[model samples]
Target: MTVYIDDAVHPWRDQRWAHLMADTLPELHAMAAQLGIPRRAFQNRRSGAHYDVPAPMRERAIALGARAISRHTDRELLKAVIANARLQYDATA
Candidate 1:
């Protein structure tokens, strides 16, 4: 499974944030662990299941083997990743 980190363009708290997702929930959690992110930070909402990562964390995630995706350049694949993430949550919830 592949872990994906989108461009950190969501602005909040004076810093940009991005979504950290994976092909499956387990993979997603594992990557989050590697990134030193707590499980409590997981966002399991209906919008999509993912972790909100900071801009700096985006580089770390990429270094740790996450595939970086840009919302402007990779719209279609990003949508698929998001759909898969939501499916994982839906199946278990």
Candidate 2:
């Protein structure tokens, strides 16, 4: 079980953001709590269960032990992580 933060740095509302996902919902929520992100901020979409972390917080997540994954470089692992996240969402839903 591991937490993954992607390098998808998309810009929104003038801040860059990335997706924070984990092998399980509990792990995902725990990391979000550690980052001071409220449970309400969790994105529970069918796309994938995740927390959107801003650019600066992305670095903090890495420092706190979240595995950094790049869509460009970690295609397979990223897919597996996302698949697991979607499964987690389905289980809870």
Candidate 3:
């Protein structure tokens, strides 16, 4: 039941982005609210439920207590988190 953010390395629109995820949808939205992120940013996709956070915001999210996970170094843990995120969408849809 923890909030997690991955490294801001995904590139798009001239900016690097990160994925913000949590063990549950409520926790994810709560943390995003704390980070001043709008709920409209939530990406409820088949891949996973997450918010695409920009690089600068990613750092702020980490400072605000989001655990950082890396695709390169924390593969197993990150996979588990993604699995949890997917369940969030599946439960509702």
Model 1: lDDT to the true structure: 0.92
**Where does candidate 2 have its weakest 10-residue lDDT segment?**
84-93
- Which lDDT tens digits does candidate 1 get at residues 1-93? 899999999999999999998998899999999999999998997777899999998999999999999999999999999898877676455
The C-alpha lDDT values of all candidates are: 0.92, 0.92, 0.91
* Superposed model 3: Cα runs more than 4 Å off: 90-93
- Candidate 3 C-alpha lDDT tens digits along 38-87: 99888989889999999989888989889999999999999999898887
RMSD of every prediction: 1.5, 1.4, 1.4
Q: What is the lDDT of residue 39 in candidate 2?
A: 98
TM-score of each: 0.93, 0.93, 0.92
